[model samples]
Target: IRQTFPSAYFIELTVRQAHYAIESTERLPPAHLITWVLPDYIQFPFLGGGSNGFSIGVIPFAIIILALVLAPSRKLFSFLALYLIPLGFTLSIPPFSWINNYLPPFSHMRGNLRWMVSAAFPLACLAAASIETFIEKGIAGREKIMRRTARGVAVFVIVLVFVTLASQFLAPRLIGNEDFMGKLVDFHFRGRTATLPASHYLEVAESAVRDIGNQLSFANAWWVIAILMWVGAGGFFYFIARWRPTSKTVLMLIAGAMTVNVFAVFSYQYHNFIPQEIMLQTPALVNFLKDHEPNPRRYRIMGFLIGDGMFREVLVHSPMPPQELANMERELLVNNTSVFWEIQRMDGLEPYRTLRHNQLLNTLINADKAGYIFDRENPNVRALTLDRVDNRDALRSVTPQEKIKDFLLQLPLLSMMNVKYIYSLYPLQDPRLTPITIPRPASIPVNIYLYKNTQVLPRIYFAERPLFSKNQGTEFLLEIAEVNDFRHTTVIECNDCVARPVGRGQPPKFVINEYRDGLLSVNTETTADEWLVFSESAMPGWVATVDGVPAKIYTANYLFQAIQVPPGKHQIEWRYEDIFMQKQKALLEYLEKLFR
Candidate 1:
C-alpha cells in the first residue's frame, strides 16, 4: 500500500479491481500477493470460497443464522450489520474494499482472504447471542414464556443423526481428497525435497501415518467424523436446552459441545504429535552440521532437492504439515535457503529483505565469468509467489516459464549462501559446483546425491567498500549483486564516501559477547575507518554503540548487517529489542499458531 497506493485514486482503483476479482480466489487483485489471505488459490464453495471449519459439521453457523432470524435484537443486530455483514460483503465482493484500503490496519492488510477470519469472528458473536436468546426465552426461569425449544432441537438432532448414519451405510460421495495426501506428495515430488514419493514420507521409525490406510487412502472422512461429532454436540446441547438446565449447566454444555466440535474438526486433520525422529531420522546429512557455534564464516546450508516439501508453498499454511514443519526445522538445522526461512512470519516486509535481498532473490541467475550473476531477462522469482507489497515497484507478474527457470536458477546460487553440501536429483555438473569439495567416497545409498561447495563465503565478514546506490529501489543493488567483484561490497546503494580495499575485520574483543538473543555486543579495536558486517537478517531495533555513543548500522550485501567505525579502540554493541512487543503477548501469539 505504501508503494503502489501512493494516491487515493490508485488505492481506489486497486480496491475496485480487487472487489471485481474477489469471487475469483486464484486471480486476486492488486497483483503479486495472489495467495495473500486464503491458503488455496482456487477458493472452494465455502465462505469467501473457503471456510473456517469442516463444511459438513458447521452447525454453529446455521444456528447463528437461525437465532438471528428468530430472535432479532438491535444490540446484537448492530454487531452483525456494522462488523460481520459489512466485512463479509466488502471483503468477499469489493467496492467495500475502500474501507479495508483506507482504514488503519485494514489499509495495510493485503491478502484479501484474511478477512475470512473477521467474517467468522462476528458470526461467533451472533452465535453466542443466538444461544443466549434461546436460553432467555425457553430455558431461563426469568422469562414468562415456556417453550421446549431445546427438546425440539434434540429431537431434530436425533433425526439428523439417524439420517447421517443411514447415509453412511450407502456409498459416500467419496471425494478422494479427504486429507489431500496426494497433493502433499505432488508438492514434494515437484519441489524435489524428498527422494521418494509422499507415501514414503517420514518413513524412518515407521510413521503411523503410513499405516493409517495406504499411500492412497481417505474418502470424505472429514465429513464422516465431523458429522458424528456435530450430532453428539447438537444432541447434548438440545438435551440441556430441553431440560431447562441450570445456568451453570448450560455453560458447561456449551463448552463441552464446542470442545467436542473442535476435536471432531481436529480428527479431519492429518494426525500431528508425530515423533520428530520419525521425520529427521531419514536424513543422515544433518548429522554433519552438528552443534555449529556462531562464527564469521557462513554456516548456512540450502538444500534444493533435499527435503520432502516445498519451502515457498508451505509458508502460506498455518499449523503447517509435519512434513513441511520437519523440512523447515532442517532448513535451520542446516542453515539452508530456498525455503521460507524466516524465524517468525513477518506481518510486513523487513528492511534488509525489502531493500537489499528481494531483487537478488527475484533476479535470474546467469553462469557468466562473474559466476551466477543476475539475469535481466528471467528474474529468479519462482520461490517468491507472494508480491513484495513493501516495494513500490514490485507488482506481481508471474509467467509460467519463469517459475521453472527461477527454480533452476537457485540451484547454482546455493554457494552464494555458503552452502557446504548441495542436494539434488539432477546430475551435478554446474560451473559453480566445480569449486565444491565432495565427500571422499563420493557416493551415498540414498536416492539423492549431495555435493559440497568449497568456495562458499562466510555468512558474516567485513567489506572493503559498500556498493551503494542512491535509488531506493533494489534494481541497482541487484545489478551490483551480479558483478563478479561486488561479492562482499554489495550493500544497499549509499552516498557515504568511505572507501578502501577489502580487509577482513578481526573478531571483536570479548567485552560482552552475545548472538541470536536479538542482542549483539562487541568490545573491540579498529585500526581505521571501516565497516563491520555479519550474516544476519537486518531489521529495525538493532541499536548500535561505539564507546557507549550511538552509531548507524547499514543493511549491506542484502541479507547482512554493516556498521562504520572510526580509527580508535571503542566498545560497540548492537541489540535488537522490540519496544512495543512484550513477553506475554508474544507468547500468546506463538501459542495461538499451534491450533491453526
Candidate 2:
C-alpha cells in the first residue's frame, strides 16, 4: 500500500500510525497527546521516550532558538540570559545547606533535613524572581501569558522552600516531645543492663540511630513536599496564562494542573512512604510536656524542682544494674583483676611476652571465680586481678575451711565494712555468695538460722516468723544489730510498718489495733489462746506449719487471717511454700509507736 506514496512519506505515515496506536492503548485523548507530544519527540523518559528521541527534538529546537536569537535585539537577549541564570541556579543549587551543620537542633531530623532547610531561603529568592518576571510580562498576549505562567512557577517553588524550612524547625521539636522514645530507650537500657549482656551499649546506640532516621523521613518530610506543590501551582498559572492569552483559560488550566499535581504528590507520598524510627532524647521529659495523656496506667508525680518522678522512676533512675553486686563477687572469687586497672598495675611487669596471657587474663577477669586480695592501709594492693584459680596446683595439705578463711581475709577491710561476716558463713551453695566458717567467739553470742539456698536475704525480714515452709532445706540465723550502737536486737520491721519477732521469746505487741472505717475487728479473740492476725488477699498460697502441724486459717471481715500464736514464742518455727514479697522484722517499742 505504501508503494503509491514516496518512500520517505510512507515511512513517516507508518511511524505516525504506530504512535497513534500507542497513544490510544495508553488511553490518552488525541487533544492531550497533541499538547504533550513535541513536533520532534520529547516524551517523558519513564512514559516511553528515550534520550535519542529527546535529543533529536532538543537539537532542532536549539538551532531554531539560536537563529531567533541572532535576529533579536542584543539588549533583550542579555536581559533574558540574566533572568535565566539566576532561575536555573536557584532551582538546582542549595545555598543555605553550606552552613546547616552549625544550626540548632530544632527538629528531630539528622542529616538531609538540615540540607533542605539551608536551601529554603535561596529557593524562595529564585521563586520570587520568576514570579516578578511573569508579572512584568503580563497575561494579555499569548507569548506574555506563557511568560507569566513561567513566573508563577516561582511562587510554588518558594512555597515549597518555606514548608521545608518549617519542617526543619518543627520536626525536632515534635520528635523531642514523644513519650514512646523515652519508654523505649528506658526499656532498652534497663532490660539490656539487667540481663548483663556484654555488648549492650553498642546495640543501644545502633538502635537509637535507626529510630532517629525513621522519624525524620516519615513524620517531617511530607510537609516540605506539600509546600513545594503550592509554589509550583503559581508557576503553572504564570505559564498557562501566557500560553492561552485569556484570563479565564489561564485560571482554569493552572487551577486544574495545580490541583492534580498537589493531590498526586500527596497521594504518592502517603502510599509510598517508607516506615522509619523517630529519634528521641529525654523521652520521659518530652512525654511529660505533652500533658502525659499517652499512658494512663502509671501514676506520675513531678517534684517541685527535680522534674517528673514516678514509681517507674526506680527503673529509669537506676538504668544501670547493681554493678557493685556483680563486681564485688567477681573480684572476690574469680582471681580476675579490674580490667580498668590493667595499665596502672602491670606497667613494668615484663613477666610474659605472648598476648596469650593477656587473653587468658581477660577470660579469667570476666568469669565468676577469680578472687581479689587487698591491703587496708596500703595505697597499692596486690592480687591476681585476672588469673583464675589454679585447680591443678591445689595443695591437699590445706583444709577447705582454711582456704575459705584465707579467701575472706584476702578481701579489703571486711569487718569495718560489716561484709567480713559474709566470710564466717562457710560454703554458701548459691552462685552469688561464698561462705566461710566463723569460729565461736566467747564474748559474742551466736544465733544461727540457715535460709534455704533459693531464698535471698530480702531487704525487709518479717520478725513475726523468720522461718517459713520454703526454709525446708538448709537455714542460717540472721544476726540483727542496731546500726548506731551495734547492739543485737530480736525484732525487725520492714519499711512499710510491718513487724515480727526473731529472738528467743514472744515479741511484745508493738501497736494497739484501732478501727476507723468500721467496727473493731479481730481474727481470734486474744483469749489466753494465742493467735496472730495477718492481712491476706486470698488463701495465702503458702500455709505455715508449726512442728509439722498446720496452723488454723482464720479469715477476718477485712480479709485477714489469724494464726494460732504459740505461747511465749518459744522457738515455734513456721515456714512458707512461697517467698515473702517484703521482709518482716520485729518492731522496736520506741520505733513502732512513732511509725504507727
Q: How accurate is candidate 1 locally (lDDT)?
A: 0.45
lDDT of 1 by residue, 193-261 (tens): 442334444232122222222211234454344445535555555555456668777667666666655
Regions of candidate 2 where Cα sits further than 4 Å from its true position = 1-98, 102-109, 115-129, 138-244, 270-596
Mind giving the per-residue lDDT tens digits that candidate 2 earns over 45-111? Answer: 1123211111112112222233333334444455445544433322222342222222322111122
RMSD of 1: 12.2
Q: Cα lDDT of all candidates, in order?
A: 0.45, 0.30
Residue 373 CA displacement from its true place in model 2, Å:
30
Span of ten consecutive residues with least summed lDDT in model 1: 38-47
**Each model's backbone clash number:** 18, 76
